[model samples]
Every structure is written in C-alpha cells, then in structure tokens.
Target: MDANDFVEIDGSYLEGGGQALRNALSLSCILGKPVRVVKIRANRPNPGLSHQHLHGLDLLRDITNADVVGNVLLSTKVEFTPRTILDNTYRVDTRTAASITLIYQMALPVLLFAGRSSRLIVSGGTNVAFAPPVEYMQQVLLPNLKRFGAGFELKVQQYGFYPRGKGTCQLDVQPVAKLNAGQFMDFGRINLVSGVGFCAGRLPVNIAIDMQQTAQREIHRLWPEQECTIETVKHSPEKTRDNGAGILMTANTTGGVVLGASALGKKRIDGHVLGSEASCQLAEYMRKEICVDDYMQDQLIIYMALAVGRSRMRTGRLTKHTRTAIHVAEQMTGVKFDVTVEPGGQTLVTCEGLGQLNKLI
Candidate 1:
C-alpha cells in the first residue's frame, strides 16, 4: 500500500506522548492498515523516538514483516506498513532501563490476532519510573484481560530498575479467533489484597520484608477483616544493573475488579512511607467505585475497540493518555467510541469493535 493510502495520525492530537505512537503501531498491525504518525512525542522533553520507542517499533517491524521508515532514534515522524503477521518466538533486549511493560503492550494486541501462538522474551526495566511494573501486569491487568477471554502468561526471571536495567521476563500468548468484548461496570466488594515486596542489586532482603510488613499492617488497619498477603522477593545483585527496592499491592474485588498501586524505593527513602503510599492508593481506587483505574482504562481502549461486540467500562476519570489512545484507535481502525461523564464525575467509555479475524493459513 502506498503511504498516501495509510491513515494519517497527528502525534500532537491529544497528550502528544509516546502512547499515540504505540497505539498506532498496534492498530496498524491488527487492521492490516499502514499508518503515518507525524510529530511523534511532540510534547515530551527531547521529543521524538527514544531507545524504548524504537525498540517497540522495531519489534513490530520484525513480527509483521512491515516496512518502517523514520525509525531512527529521535525521529519526529514515522510510517509503518504491515504486510503480514508472523507467529513465532521472538527475543528483544532493550539494552537499557526502558520499560518492558510498555514494550509488551506494543506487541500483545496484534500478536493475539496472529493466527498462532507467540512467545516473547523481553529484557529491560521491569519495575521502573513512569511505567507500569511487571507485578501490575501479572497480578491486575492479565487477570482482567483473561475475563475477556485473552490467554497469556508472564514469568519474571530477574528484577530491574531505573538507570541500570537488566531485568528479564517472558510472555507466552495464545492467539484468538476473536476477542470477547469486556464489560467492567461494577467494582464489587473487596475480597483479597495481596502484593510483593522486592529488592535487588546489593539491597538487603530485610528491606523487602519490612516493606511487606508495613503494607500488610496498613491494609489490616483500614479493613480489619481484609486479608493482605505479602510476598518478599530477594533477587541476586549480579542479575540487576543497580540497587533498587519496591512494593506492588493489589486489591481484588468480588465483582472481578483488580486495582493495583506501587511505590519505588530510593536512596534515603523511607520504606514505611513507600508501603503506606501503595496501600493508600489501592484504598483510594476502591473508594472510587469504578471497575477500571486511570491507567487500565487507557490500556483497555484498544482491546475494546477491536473486540467482537460492544464493550463498556467505567473508569475513575478520563486522562489525556486515555483520550489519546481512543483517538488513535478510532483513526486507525475507523472504530467509533462513545465517552460520557456520569453523575459521580466518573467516565463511561463504550465502543463497538471491528471484529477482525485470526486464521492460520
């Protein structure tokens, strides 16, 4: 297809961040439509493609055998033309502290429609600043995706942090003929609260243990009947590029909702504060009475737009990231989305999916 035939997406459309680029990539591959994104990441400092963004685009190029232009680092515009989707095992090493979770998001939606199972080995920052930690993907997001009939497994081989990222993780995804539309309208009663406290690279295990205890205590104090399980993780210093500690906590509800919050440990940072902040975030989410948190709402937009039926979700609020994702998905797939503000100031997002097919040749 000629570049003129591709959908033209202005990178400055909404939040003007890397999210628009990532959404364009996934939608292009899924719909077999080429896309040209201009002014990429125009709103961020040092705007244009970074190592992490390039890594994601390169992986998409490899998987779909796509012709990609303007993929060089710090480029402000790019064109992606996907010819085919290949189902195969792939390995990607970001070789820096880039967020592996973002990389996974770039790959997952398109891979599910690849007509065969795909396995991915991605190594980079697992728990880092400005990204969703691996635990959130495993504990919260994956389970919710499973409710919509997506099947995938993630295994962490090592922990990594900012500046010196050496984390390793594996994802195995089974392709689906069509994705089921998700309905997340109710965040029912709280049932279980659990989490993992981890440290690596010269950090003592005691730090993880103490963090876990503090988080558990906070949860217990808030809801005396609520059970919070804390798992302490000790990773080898040799496996990580630098020292780091963090905690990720989740609250699972009877209405099949999962809310997650995390805190990163820093030099001279107080562990108790980290734990308290994590637990408090989870509590705040529960009080909001929405099924999806702010981040998950953005993450689910693409999937909902691609599913087989009308999908509906109630989120705490509409963020610029989520708005940008909706716009990009609509532009690429020609899918229509309806977003409205409810009485309590929460946002309700709904869409009818394109219902694309996945079949092995």
Candidate 2:
C-alpha cells in the first residue's frame, strides 16, 4: 500500500481509549484500507496496547491475513494492512482475565465480512469491568444484531470473572452479502423483564437464588403489569479460576428493542444490593424513550453506517464513546451522521449508511 493510501488516525482522538483502536482495526479490515495509528491509548492511565488489545489485533490479523507492526504490549504506534478475509473457525485466549466480549466486538465485523460461515472460541474474562458481560452479549447484543440480517449465535461454556480470567464462549456466524439497515426509533411498550443470576466456584447456590429473588421483588414492584422471570445457575468449582457471582437483566420492549444492565459481585458486596442495583438500572432505563442504552448506542454506530439505508435511534445522554465511534465511522466508511441533543438528556441519532457490498471497498 502506498503511504498516501493508508488512512492516518490519531489514537488520542475523542475519548482516547482502547475503543479507538478497536473501531479502527475492524473498519480497516472491512474497508481493506491500511491504517497507521500514533499515540495509541495516549490518554489512558496505562497508555498503549494491553493484553486484551494485543489479542484482538492478532486475531484480526489471523482472520484477515494482515501485515501488522507495533503490536507489542504498551506500544504507542501500530500499522495494519489487510490482504484478504478468510472464513474458518479460530480460537483466541486472553490467557488471563481480560475482557473476552471486547475481543468479540472486534472480531464480529470481520467474521461477518468473511463471506462464509465462521466459528470462534473465545476465552477470557466474561464479566469484567469496563466491558459488556457475556450475558449482555448473549441476551441483548445478539438479539439486536439479528435485525441487521447477520446470523450469529453466542453460548457461554464457562463463567470467567475478574482477576483469574478463564471464561469461554462459542460464537458461530453465517456470512451475508450485505447488512440490512435497521430502524429502532420506536420503543413502544416494555412487556417483559427477564434476567439470569449465576455464581461460580465456592459461592453458595442460595446466593444466586437470593439475588434473583431480590431483583424479581423490585421489578415486580416497579412494573406490576410487566412479566419478570429470572433463572439462577451455579457452576461447579472446577469451572472457574476464582469464585464470583453476578446478575444480568434484560428489558425487552416492542419493535425488537432490548436494553440490558449487569452487576458483578465483589468481596463484602451484598448479593441483594447487587441484584437491586441491576434492577434500579433497568428501571431507570425504562423511564426514557430509548431504542438502546448508551453502550448499545456506541455499538450500533458501525453497523448502521455500513448498511445501505438510513438508521435512526433514540438513546440516553450523548457519550464520548458514541461520539468517538461516529467520528471513526465517518472517517472509514464515508457515512454522514446527525446527532441532536433532545430535551431531558435524551439524544436522537440518524445515519445515512453507504450500503457497502462485496469484499472490495
């Protein structure tokens, strides 16, 4: 690739986190455009590539057969030039308790574009901080991705929590020629609130049961008209490197809109408090006319921009994550976006997708 042909990205642009690199790498693979990034994660407390970030890049490199430089941990610069897209089952492990869901976020688009069915066995932290939990990926994100016309499935094989990360998940994807644009402007009525409460290792099974009951009690009190169901599961002690517990809540509304919130249990943290906190988060989200939550808002921007039609959604307050994603999308895909700050801290986001089809940009 010629120097002028490569897209130059400032790693410190916008929120300046690993997401900047994640979005850029996924887009580069999709667009088949080379990229040179400088000041990578420059604004983070531990700037540059971490283990999770490196594994994500390496996986992309494997799937795309890309030439990569500066992939070492804590490196501040990198270059990626994708050569081709391959469809095959691949395995990736963070080797520690890094965020596996974050790795999935990067691999999803690449696999979707591989033009053939693909399976991924991802291992790492399933319920780590600063990343969406695996339950959220299975319960919330996968359902919403179906609207984009992409066929994919996620199943958790084990629960991996923070510090000792060894969680595992299987993702199977069917290729599609092009992604259909999805509209999510309507959030009609929330009819069901469902969830999962689970624990691994030495925690008593009753801990999960108590959490589920607490969440059910609160949700029923708040929306008596809505149906609430929670399943409790306990994994064997051998399934995890450490003991952990948590709850994941999903609110499904009309028009295929889904919102999710999750809380991880810690030492000295009460299970009832964790369950109630998750319920409160869901209740607060229900108070707004949102098609998705702030996290989902950021997640959808890339897909919406890649589709061939207009995509519109309503979400909570404008976040730097969303803004950063919008910036990256415009730069990589030539999609135009309109963001309006609505009354009462809500936002309306509209995008005109380029409708890209085929393997070439």
Q: Provide the RMSD of all predictions against the true structure, rounded to 1 decimal.
A: 1.6, 1.7
lDDT of 2 by residue, 206-263 (tens): 8888889899999889877778999998888666747888999999987678999898
C-alpha local distance difference test of each model: 0.87, 0.86
Candidate 2 global lDDT: 0.86
Whole-model alpha-carbon lDDT for candidate 1: 0.87
Clashes of each: 0, 2
lDDT of 1 by residue, 29-100 (tens): 988888999999999998999999999999999999999899999999999999888999999999998999
Model 2 per-residue lDDT at 108 = 94
Compute the lDDT of residue 4 as modeled in candidate 2. Answer: 89
